[model samples]
Target: MTQAAADPRYGAAPPPRRRWRLSWNDPRTRNLAVQAAAIAVVAAAVWYLAGNAGRNLAARHIATGFAFLHRVAGIPIAEQPIPYDPATSTFARALLEGVLNTLKVSLAGIVLATILGTFVGIARLAPNWLLSRLAAVYVEVLRDIPLLLQLLFWYTLLQTLPAPRQAVHLGPAFLSNRGLRLPGLVWQPAHSWAALAALAGVVLSVLWARRARARQDATGVRPPVWPVAVALIIGLPVAVWAVLGAPLGFDVPVRKGFGFAGGVTVSPEYAALLAGLVIYTAAYVAEIVRSGIEAVPRGQWEAAGALGLRRGAILRMIVLPQALRVIIPPMTSEYLNLTKNSSLAVAIGYQDIVSIASTTLNQTGQAIEGIAIIMAVYLVISLTISLFMNWYNARVALVER
Candidate 1:
């Protein structure tokens, strides 16, 4: 054989690379192509809807732009967080006031409901026959009734009260068909400094709490931090006020002429809305809390008891820590429900975001803009609450190494 054959080397060539194909032959590329197609379809549908809306709007001669938001609202609003005169203020300001009103009631309702629910939930588990029965009745009654009926009932009840001249007075608070008037703070120059001092005290209290928790983790000894926190929060603020000559003052609502003149007024509509939201929401929260508490095994409680821990301590330390892991997810849903239910304020004329936005839509004939604004406001609020709860859930969740 020749030298090439003796070396076992022959003419060799690499196979020609196949032309790249863009189909499911490659799983990844196919998946990406499918997703791209889906996105394109969605985008096209949105564009079509937009164009159709514009044409219909033009045919109807209804103005579609948000420029109308700058024009005078020309509609009366009975309740507002900030002073708003429709004759004087722009529609934008009116809408903003509505958003603020919605937020005010929502935040207040959450706090009150939470506190009320916690008590009712604990009462459900109470050994005393009367307490548990009462709790059960409350939960069943409130939960079974329609929230709309509750709202209307409360509104009717508030409207039946006597007028401002014959207002029911209780200490610094007054109630009447006109509204519930509460003594409001009359801010003095020193109050600003006092507020700052109070804020500082809260920061210090949080820091001290973390330190105490860390110390307990290391040494198995937990110092009571609640007393110190209370002192720092309440006592420090009081001390600051005293140092500044206690310039604390109040604007007490007094019967003046035909109506109360001084103090913060919670309109009857607002009062009913808040009361209804709190009561309706608390029932569900109570159930969630009770279920969370019960989720903890009996063995855990018995073990804690055997270890010489008081019932209260066991409930607080061992049971709650475990129960919270179950509670937070459902509790978050209840909060969201309360927020959405606040929209029912419109039915009773409470002037929430949805109510005001509906008025704006009618007056301006800008349905799209008004609806969009309402949706955006609610989305932002719901997301904020969800994010905070999610972060807290993550912190409390069991961490397995």
Candidate 2:
């Protein structure tokens, strides 16, 4: 700098580099300051609104807080996964029952929708033109129809079915206006113990799989996982059942007068809701799956095929795994949407959380608390789903060696 500046050959030395300062003139500083101000404004607005609500509630002599949760709830819920007596149960218990009911439908819908959607998505790209077209039509029709309308249609269709005595028989199951009656287990303590063992076996199988996968990465050869998984998950459960004196009783349904008795009853309300949610959500999920599969380069398929791999093998072994990285994020949203969409159960007289809360608020006139409970329930559910899906997504993400 000294020689060049003195000689005027390199012009003046460049100005000293400026150190960033937290001033209004600096863009980064100004942006942060603006964000802080916006956040403060939002906080202030929330505070004012909350204070006003409290004052209004107080002025009206309306009691607040969650004390009403302990009060008896007289709302009759048709489908309860847990024991719930409307006459004796508190609002808290009733609401808990509602939560369980919502979860029942939501969990089932997610599983069924995933399965159906994946198949339809694959069918969309099938070599058979008719199958592809049919799949396309199915996706288009389902996506275009409003979910609420579909729910209503399913409900109406179920209601029009023949009565209990004239139920359409399908093997051990029967469908009628009352509900679908299916064979069920005469559950026992032994069965419960076996189920617990099976769950433990599943956890152990997952651990074993991880170990096997790690071993495969370190060594070229991988150990078979299925045999060990089966031994743990199935054999362990059977052993537990046998040790506990295996009880294999079945609760077969029998026509008892006007209605069926024994076994399990899939109420029309639940069936309609479950069917509608799965079918409608599957269309969106199908599109997502198709896009994800398509995202896998054609070269991948060609490479796998060139190695003498069948189309199914290429898809299951290679393409599907790669496609998962693309599929999981949007798939998470579909799951959330299905869960949230279940709130619509109230429209068809299905006693989900929203329905129970609405009834509780109406009878008790504790609208704020009731609504808060619903918001909290959904918030918890959405967060849990998001967290699980994000974890899965990370696991499937590409890793560079």
Candidate 3:
């Protein structure tokens, strides 16, 4: 054989390289082209609509910016988380109060709903026939009913309660048509310091718990967390309070003539809204929890039991950790739903962001700006919840080594 043919480096001329060509047939190229076109169309539409709205508002002698937010808002809000004088407060402050009120209801609803729903979910799987049946009925009925109707029903029901003079007494709390009046703390500087200390303790306890878990994973023995947690979380706060003279004053409610004074007053509108949202949202959360628990294999339960583990211990240690991976994603959605559903407070007279925004627009005639504020507030809230939940989901997700 010739010298050139004998060597692989001198093999027949290499096949010509195929020139790159874009085509609709290529999935990646097609997808990018389609996405770009769609984005451009959306951008153009938004720009044109905004310009048209501005021009029309100008022609009709209406204002178009957020300048109205600084103007005096004489809107009387019944429930203000912070001090607000309608005559003196600006529209921005009023809106901020609205935001706080919304957060109060939404956060409380999420917490209460989670606790109640988890119990209901467990009850649905109980051995007792009656308890399981009752739980099932609750989930089915609540899920089927319209949330608006429930809100209306609860509001009407609360309206029928006896007046403050004839309020039902339960310990330091009173229930009346006015609303629930609960004993409150006469807050002071010492309490504030103690609260800060308690918060700091919580952060420290969480860090310790994480470190303990890591130690347990590396070694065989797990360190006790409760003792340290209690000392930091409870003892630290108590010590702080003691150092500041231990001001433990209570603001007890007392009836004057028609209404009560001196205690924390929960308005009827807030009571109705919270009752409606918590009860309605809990039903769905129950179903999600139930499904997550059932997703654990029967064999895992049997194996744990065979190893002489109690049912509760098996659940707490072995099953729940796995079940959480399934539970968190759906739970995040429920939280978001509860937050958004709070907008319905407008119907019940609760001065949430949406309700306050509507009143603000009517008074100031900044229709676009008011609506934009409401939209922006909810968008930010939703995104924040999503990001936190996503981060937590990633933390609890299964990892294979």
Candidate 4:
């Protein structure tokens, strides 16, 4: 009674304190709920689209299944690296062959473009004015033109050569409208062993270089790693070849009535496609390289020179190491672009993945499956390249504090 008289506002019982529950009222929980709702909407949309596609296919009297892949591909391919018989192989095998060819071209193009681009990039930075200007012009001219035009130009140039019957002979090689026939290396079992040894030598050399760099970092003394690495990589392979009795033979091309006999003939279509891809892609790669090199601060070069390092040493040790961090990521994209651009082979009848897939689509009337296979192959290639480049980029990335 005395407390109530002192505080009339304080009733018989205080109001219960409000309790907060750890639930969707939290920001993170609310965000999660929103994301879940969005995903459900997307799934519903996909289901609706898929249902529409099913109805459309049914109305067109088209069978929607992968069973057609087993059917025989009646059309014959002109030049397959593997042993493929049109009458014996299924459509799946034909598609596989096409995919392999595409891979071959893309891989070769990447290697060639990298070498050419790096050289051109370095040349553009040369102290010699003429050389630098020349490289600049090359990059500019090639990059400006469409790749398709370049491909056609090369194909036409090749076609303008003499007929196969009167081929322009260059020692053991012959050039004609049909193709350029050069000496082919006849591989023996021992050659395969030598190749394996070369690969092992490269792996060993990389490991050795890494160890040497680690040792140098610990002691602050740089050893002559380049010569040692090169010797290990090249000399080991040569030694392996010598040990295998040097089993090497070349098949020279000889003019035979209507065509060249022997030797490995590179079809004009393949040559044109390769030339176009390399030149066009090299221009872009050159730009990337140039930008990367330029991104390296002038202070780095000045510091290296102040340390009494030679120009070559500064470039090899200081400049390039840092420049590569900038170069690799964009360079990888260019490599992928070149790979996909190789589909332009259809214009020149090179029978690359797209060309072959298109042919299959026409013949089998399985547009969906044919297109899916092509997409899958390209997706795999792009993913593989991205994974490798990302791993390499991570290795070279600057360690931050």
Candidate 5:
């Protein structure tokens, strides 16, 4: 063998030293270079677009700043939960009121939709053919329809109801085209204290339940949790209320000459929006719930049954906890969707954030400012929900060693 070939590290002319290239020849360097180029292009495009917008606004004699935020909105919002006067409040304040109304509708819709969806989802799995088919029909029909059309249908249906003078009475409640009147709770200072105490008690009960569950898992003995939960959630509140002189009263709805009187009336627009949102969103939520429940392995059911657990116990103890891990992420998305879809309130003359912002834009010719406000409000809501959901997901995720 030749002297050069005898040394293992020495090859035949070292295979011609290839120069390291910074281009696509090297995968890592090429990817980094491509990403850098893409970022620069995007940055340049954004700057150009922003500059064009500024120039266009200036040429059109419109201010490009946020000074319009402080100007008076000069519009009255009927049926605001918080006290709002157009003459006294700034455009910002009116926008805040609209945001709150949007939140109220979305929050209520999420709660109602979850309850209805869960029931319908469980029903779809029924052993009885009629019950399962009924649930399937509901899911298919509702999910197939456009949400906007649903909203319109609900609004039209509400408008066709009898006028205030001939309102339908349901015990202490009244229903009419004008609104649905229900009894309102009159609260005193003591009621506030009772509410605070009740909230604290509920929080404490949840902590106790968590601890009890951990102890039970370690010792193979489950504690009686329901009675403690009930006491903390219900009895504590009642106890505090009694101690605080029971400062609570109901203002029941009563029939009056032209309208119902002495109760809180929810306008038809609000009712229609809420009802449509809940029903439409519930369809999607039902599907998510059904899929989640179905994803739980059949072995779990069999194992629980073999352990002599009742069907309800098997569902509550073994099935739901596992199913929730799959359910929560998609459920969070549905909630966020419902919140954004609430913007459709504009179609029915409901004073939601989008509707109010549109009116403000038309009145002040401050389209940019109005759009910015709407976008920021929605972004905040989306971010807040995403953060909470991510935190919850992390907590519930399966652990591995």
Candidate 6:
């Protein structure tokens, strides 16, 4: 400043030119250079590996394309949701079936684990000593043991049950060494129309809810919507079912062959995987829930109590709302973990995506493609879950503004 003010010739300072060589002293330049170099190395490594793989495949006379997907799978799938015959089906179709099986277990496991975990979490905080201790014991015992062992144990236990002829029966349901068979709903073509009607009802209900919310916001009065909700959700569906000739039929399991047939057949392998995933995930979720509940300040509970609110009312109106803000974030992570862990079903012969894809890889000798397919599927699934959870977290987050 002194030099610029003193001399008219040097009235303004010149901007410093960037150096041609990256200076270690300049943090921005150094970081950029290091990142660029690292990226270049990684890119080179990937290109080299791909080239090597191509040469190896050519040398071995092995095909390296997804064209095999259209070829006959010639592999029987037992847990298929839809009809498939190994004699006529393609490998791509089988792979799709494997994906469905994975989703089927993962989605159901998520719901069941959440419910059971919530119960255990509440029990852990119970006023009664016995209940809390029991919940603590359960969490400690189940989470500590290896998950694979749990799957194996449940699978073996199911296998030790009586045969189909001597099954444990409760009305239409039957349990045996093979699996548990229950009443299954057979969806006919007419049911498609019924489903569309139900979907329409759902859309209408959502629109109605928005209008109701707007009305309440303006008037500070909430209308009773239970009757409308019930009629739209339940009555509309039932009316559609009846109008569509009641196309739904139940297939009740009966002792027919060595194993029960002609009903919703839950194989032992599937049951074991489901049970293990649910139990293991529930323990982790329970701890998360307990911690979330504890994170809520005690003063809030006391204030609600002093207002003469009943126990259940205090919990529903004050405690739970605050607790849920904390609970949801960790709960989302647990759900993602449970879904990823479904791959472990292969150990129990559950024929999830990993299992079927691995078998296909071994038989077809397309190791790279098989692994790529698995990785792509998992990547897509994880990304989808992450995006959805983030959106929901934003919705429930506290607004400081």
Q: Pick the candidate with the highest lDDT.
A: 2
Computed on alpha carbons, the lDDT of every model, listed in order, comes to 0.91, 0.94, 0.93, 0.88, 0.89, 0.88
Candidate 6, residue 128: Cα displacement in angstroms equals: 1.1
lDDT of 4 by residue, 130-220 (tens): 9999999999999999999999999999999999887887888888899989999998888888888788988988898898899899998
Poorly placed runs, candidate 6 (over 4 Å): 1-31
* Candidate with better lDDT, 2 vs 6: 2
* Clash pairs detected, candidate 2: none
Q: Please list the Cα RMSD from the true structure of every candidate, rounded to 1 decimal place.
A: 8.6, 5.4, 5.9, 9.1, 6.8, 5.8
Q: How close is every model to the real structure, measured as TM-score?
A: 0.89, 0.90, 0.90, 0.86, 0.87, 0.90
lDDT of 6 by residue, 179-228 (tens): 88999988786777777877888887887888888889999887766677
Writing each residue's lDDT as its tens digit, candidate 5 over 1-401 gives 48868887886455775676777888777889989999999999999998999999999898667777788878999868788889988888888889999998988999999999988888898788999999999999999999999999999999999988888888888888988899999868877877888899889898989989998999989888889988988888789889878776899988777776798989999999999999989888888989988999999999999999998898888998899899999999999999999999999999999999999888888888889889999999989988998999888888775
Best to worst by lDDT, what's the order? 2, 3, 1, 5, 4, 6
For candidate 2, what is the lDDT? 0.94
The parts of candidate 5 lying over 4 Å away from their true place are 1-32, 210-224, 253-261
Q: State the weakest 10-residue window (summed lDDT) of model 5.
A: 11-20
Model 4 spans with C-alpha error above 4 angstroms? 1-24, 207-232, 235-245
**Candidate 3 per-residue lDDT over residues 58-77, each given as its tens digit:** 99999778888888899998
What is the C-alpha lDDT profile of model 1 across 218-256, one tens digit per residue? 999998899999999888988998998998679998888
- Pairs in steric clash, model 6: none
Which residue runs does candidate 2 get wrong by more than 4 Å?
1-35, 170-172, 214-221
- As for lDDT, the candidate ahead, 3 or 4, is 3
